[model samples]
Target chain A: MNCLLCNCQLSMRLCITELFLPIDHQRETVCDACRARFSAYHLSKQCCPGCGHPLNGELLCSECQAWKNNYGQFLHHRPLFHYNEAMAEYMSLYKFQGLYQLRMVFQHVVQMAIKQEEYDLLVPIPVSPTTLRTRGFNQVEGFLEGMQFHQLLTTIDDHKARQSARTRQERLVSQQPFQLNNNVRVTGQHILLVDDVYTTGRTLYHAADLLWQAGCQRVKTLSLAR
Target chain B: MQKTDFYGRRVLLNAEEAQQIRIPNLEIMPAVKKNGDRIYCYRCGQTSSCDTSHLPNNQYYCPVCFNLGRSSSLACYGHLAEPNHFTLPTSILTWSGQLSPLQKRVSQAIDQGMTNHQRQLLWAVTGAGKTEMIFAGIAHALARRERIAIASPRVDVCLELFPRLQAAFANTPIALLHGRTPEPYQYRQLTICTTHQLLRFYHAFDNLIVDEVDSFPYAANQALLFATNNAVKKTGGILFMTATPGRTLEQQIHRHQLHVHYLPLRYHGHLLPQIKINLAPRWRKNMERGLLPLTLIRSIKATLSAQHQCLLFIPHIDDLPLVEQVLYRQLTNSRFTTVYAADPQRIEKVQAMRDGDYDFLITTSILERGVTFPEIDVYVLGADDSVFSSSALVQIAGRAGRAVTRPTGRVIFWVSALSRSVNDARRQISLMNRKGRCLQRELSSL
Candidate 1:
């Protein structure tokens, strides 16, 4: 097998325990060198409790503080990886370039990260109909392949600009683009929203706001990158 | 996009762009085809299982040629029939450079091949002025109003060849295309692009010349070969130029399927520099311990004393820092630097080397070809490594003895153990040199 990112041949050596046990293990899609490029956030690091943003012994980041003032509560966001150059490149290829096979590169890691969270419904942020028609897949849902997830929200705006193309201020003040699916039961239920990246937490906030209006008891968020 | 953009080209377009082009001559085709459980890309001609490349709603995109554009089922290809629209220019060949008698013969053969629309391969040695020789054929094709494109596997080679081709055909408009070219595609009589760009073309060129046919990505890639075959018209001519032909080309030559021409001597009429092998066992271990082999260091010193720059080729980029540390410690007064593909200042460092800023450079296989430095001796630290293919070794040796002032430079390979590629490289060089010697003797008798 070759690394999905770099296309280098991957050499697999079975350990003594594995040789005896003979259990089928999921093969790695990326080589160790390419895998090392992505840096996972350590839970013990000093970070904002709300958004997982690195902080100096602060309870919440300034962005989260602003969110708390607007909404009754800030989102409990857990990002798996830092938004480094490698992650940016990965996102560009996986999302913009539409190399669908690249979704497999982070599938296992994202699945494992989501397994640690407790939620009644695992909801993924939806793409605009235009994006769904053009890009052919919701990038957030692509990471959650082969897992049970609820498509509880749908984008109502047809001309919603991509978050990547908008400036930070434009993204912050942009109107909510998402709406709850008709006849979805989320009342008094814990909801977990999934997204590909947490840029300014605006996208997830929009989705969470809809779920909150739908009478969800609580809302949490997870992303592949922050 | 204009009608001219789709002329002789197959560009993937969305529904909006497809609706804009209303020409009756436009041939629209699906970007990808589905058969059972497989998806076949029409552009690259590769079949993939639907599971790996599928989109939502039973749509599939080709991941192989994604760099060109996303060729999913949602997109369609726009192709306009090639009208061979070219204005005959008063003067096509602006290059006044003269080819030698042997090179002139090969140039005439190429011109004839192009005229007859035949497939041919020109096996010319390094520094044989292959570009100058092809000017006559390209000019002939242009005069005949035949569309032409010259492609290479490496972008660096295409970038280096574009300006030279523009200068040669000064009266003709030329388009340059690559994965990174920002300008939109235009209809031009002549085009120079990388081989990957050929996937965007549909029987575009009547005469296609592929340089460095044995180079990376082109030699080992089947999709590129399919694209090359698809880019040319059914009756069009193709000329493959390379110093070393790989196994596939060699088999074609043996089967008499490919017409072959050989220019065994350099333009300066000198035999290639012979490779001298030096066994340096445990060199990697010693390098980690911060020590280079005594013989390698002495050779570098000798080449420096002779006022020639040195090119130290290592097997991998990971070994560079180790070799660099030892070089700095041993030759503290000598000016040197390291370079690799990922180095941000790669182009600048190569320019600096050309400006005589450094006495030597430690580099990976990225600099194995398409670079010429005068008065330089080459030393391959690990010639037996699997990374150094036979052709790569030959190209690395070709880097030496390029300039007329110093037609004979040293090429040494420090190998821990002898390998087949090493033997093949040595044998290939000697075979060409012998052929060159025979040509010289025949010319002298004449």
Candidate 2:
């Protein structure tokens, strides 16, 4: 098999794990060099209870504290990776360049992260109609390939620009863009809002606000990047 | 958005606009296509079985061409018969530089091709002033109020050509587009862009000149060839400029599908530096043991003693550190640097070599064609290695004897054995020299 990114042939050999395990679980999309470029967030690192930004040893970061102060509700958002320059480039190629094959690079890790959580349902942030037409795949939903997710929210605003295209101030001041579908019912369930990145947190907050209004008992969030 | 924004532009539409926009003569733009479960972009077609684009119910956007803006199945192309703007310059050829008599003749031929909208190949050798030869033809097309674009496969080539073309046609508004450029693209009389950027244009240019058509990934890519054909109007002209024309192009010329114009001689009227082969068996093993071939070391010492820069082209990038280690011990007093394609300091290192900061640059074939350095000798270690193609070998030889001041430089192919590619490259260089001699004789007679 060839590496998905570089097209170099992947040298696969039967290992000790193959003898013990009947089924093969190795699904490496990127070469070791490419995989090394991305610095994955260690699960052992101490993170802010609200947004999951790594804090060396502190219980809560200033940003999450400020978030708690602004909105009475605090979201327990667990992010898988830190938003570094390498991650920025990765996102630029995967999200902006629309290289859909890149989604698989983070597939197994994201699936494992999702499996660790015990949310009643997964609610991926919906892309606007314009984004749906232009980008084809919703980038937020792209990482959750084999995972079960509920597309219970749809974009209600057509004029709103993408969160990625807006500035931090613009994203913060942006109005609500999503509306819950008629069939979505989480009256007493723990709803998990998933997104690709947590930039200003306003996009997820907007989704959470509508879900709370729709009578969800509690709301937590998960993202690939912070 | 206003209707004017979409005019003569490739834009995606929502489900409502896809059904409602009924512009006459509109077509499902060839840029976007719907394959079974995935949408194949007529642009950058990246085929992977797992297409995740969740377009609104069966619609698809080609993720491959997303860098040039999105091309999706739900989009429709609305093209104007002619560009909305055209301003003919009073003096199109603003540069005061002179072309050689042979170049003038070739320039006239290209101008005539532009007049007749013919597909012609300007098979010029490296350092033949290929860019300058196109000025007269571009001026002709500009005076005719036709849209023109000079596309190359390499962004470095496009970047290098943009300023030169800009200076040549001082009055013309030129737009340059590439993958990493932050400048927003706008319609211009003369557009200079990488071949990949041509996907965004639809029948946009009347005179399309493809420079370095033999360079990769454009030489081997059918999609880019299609983009080139689809970019120009049906009646538009195409002039291909290249130092090394590939087999397909040769076949096309023989079949009379492509008209050929030869400018085999460099503007300096010098022959290409012929390649000299020296065998060094078990060179890799020798290098691993810190043993250097005395002949190769002698060549490097001679080139350095002559106060000329040299490029040592290794077959693989992995061989760089080992080669550097061996060379550093032998030539400790000399200033030499190693670079490869992904070297972080590749640009700076090449610049340093050009700026006369380094005596020699040990590199891979990444610096094969786009770069130019004066009075430089070239040595290719492992020339018999399959990593070096025939065209690449020719280009490597073309690197020598490029500058007008020192138009004769040494090019040695140090190899274990003479490969077919090496022979073909040697033959091609000598063949061009013979053609140059004939052309020179013909010019003198005329």
Candidate 3:
């Protein structure tokens, strides 16, 4: 494998002796040349702590600024891919087609985005039963394999309040907040929520609110594509 | 976004897994599976996929974000693709062509009445050639350029009848839609599908004919019936085919509210099958562990010595292997094979038997209906077991006498108790044959 930028051979480079050394594959791949370049890339420019849009910080993206009056504040969110044809087909096959091999493809893309990024936990957005039934496997969970699991960052809303709301956003806003199972401790913990594609950030914001309310110090999201 | 952690033993997705897509207005969810790799939701029917709602009343619902949804019904991906055979009837005539006078008359009434009415039920008796009766209706609708759909609850039976239906009509396009097949038949003139698959059509089919309406999976779910109706074209027709009508339909039949036609006897004049019962000690238990309760074993051996063919029907799929093994040991000299729905080689094994390669065939209720054997006597080792409903038992009994020359055969229900299914089966057949005799006598007088 050759680096897209440098054309340097991108094989896992290590001496036979380094086999016993503790290492992170992501760190190895985020080479000095690549890491330094990625750090400066305009795509990684600072944005609102509440949203990952181009930030003048004068106002929040409509999703974040008015979210509290509606859903709530998101500490921050990030996406690796723009919602496009490649990611759509990739996620479709990953979720619907039951293409297990594509997990490696997803992992590679996710790994590159998360390079040197720190989070106490990486939560996967949950898939519903209806969706899971249609596709034998959950593609979000499919993409999350071999990665750390965390608390449910998002959830559906109130049992009765949304007795009238039909839109998915209404469903999300009205949904009861999703939390981790009984055993996990997320207080003061920073999290990296992972998903296949980045959609309207309502699901992510609600997930952040739940974690924040549960005392998580920070909540960040990372997806295969924006 | 929130960080969520689940203490539940997380999920694993493997190759060969059935995946249901989250998309609506698309038949894209992975097929629900009885056995294969599947990731189930916390709610629903405790299978792959689930209703997204949780309840405080201790009822089953989604455990995660509460989204109200239905139970986890298994997904059927649709039918497998087979080459379409639409050749018009030529030298190849149908089984209906050989129907007796009474059979023809009753079938004609059913054909005319059912298609004439927009919504009606038809209660045909156990030995009635229901499929044969429907050919005229199917032909009538086709002649008017109307689309027709004939579906059954059992996939195995629809598969058995598909080729037969294709053979009956010439140059008529017929598509057999089921879970295993992928393509939707938007263009085909005729469709035969399993009832579970009707949910996918959503008003795509016209002239919906549901065979075995009072059967499982569909029987328990009212939504299935709704879905069946939903599959039909507006102002279209529904013709339900059943050996035994339910209480409501029976009442309708008595009131002449339902358009019912009866074929009391086999197409050819054959006596109703003889039912010989033996109350042996846990016959199935003895048969397992290679012991066939001496008495039953001896009877089987005696039949084998006479060079007669036999079909052994066990009650459950779980008992199939043991039943097969025991029968194999006892009838070592006979050509025999076992087939079941679970066995991928099922079609192959049945085909082998059809080819006259096997003298003895062991099977389960999967072959209880629609399949025909030349002259094989059937032994329902656990016939009186609760699994064999009255209708199922009657259908199984009908299998013995479908072919004219093979009309006379032995049917043994080696059971511990006289189950209602067994008794009802006996009564229904006896009553039908008695009706047949009365009709014959009336005809002679006329």
Query: Which stretches of model 3 miss by more than 4 angstroms?
Result: A1-226, B1-100, B115-129, B138-148, B154-194, B200-207, B214-221, B229-237, B244-257, B284-290, B324-335, B351-357, B443-446
Q: Who wins the lDDT comparison?
A: 1
The share of true interface contacts that also appear in candidate 1 amounts to: 0.72
Q: How displaced is residue A109 in candidate 2, in Å?
A: 1.6
TM-score of each: 0.92, 0.86, 0.54
Residue-wise C-alpha lDDT for candidate 2, range B1-446, written one tens digit per residue? 34433434455554466578776555445556655665566655554232555353555566555556556565555444445477677888898898777888898999999889989999989877788888888888888888889999988888889889899899988988888889666668888989987866667778899998888888877678878887888889999988888777878999998889988888778788999999999888888899868998999999999999999999999899999999999998999999898899999999999999999999999889778998999999999999887889999988898888999999998888888989988988888999988877877788
Better of 1 and 2 by DockQ: 1
Ranking by DockQ: 1, 2, 3
lDDT of 1 by residue, B361-410 (tens): 99999999878998899999989999998999999999999999999999
- DockQ computed for model 2 against the true two-chain complex using alpha carbons: 0.38
| Candidate number of the best DockQ | 1
TM-score of 2: 0.86
True contacts kept of each: 0.72, 0.40, 0.08
lDDT of 2 by residue, A51-150 (tens): 7666887777887777778776778888888888778988887777666667887878887888888789898988887766556678878788777899
Structural RMSD, model 2: 3.9
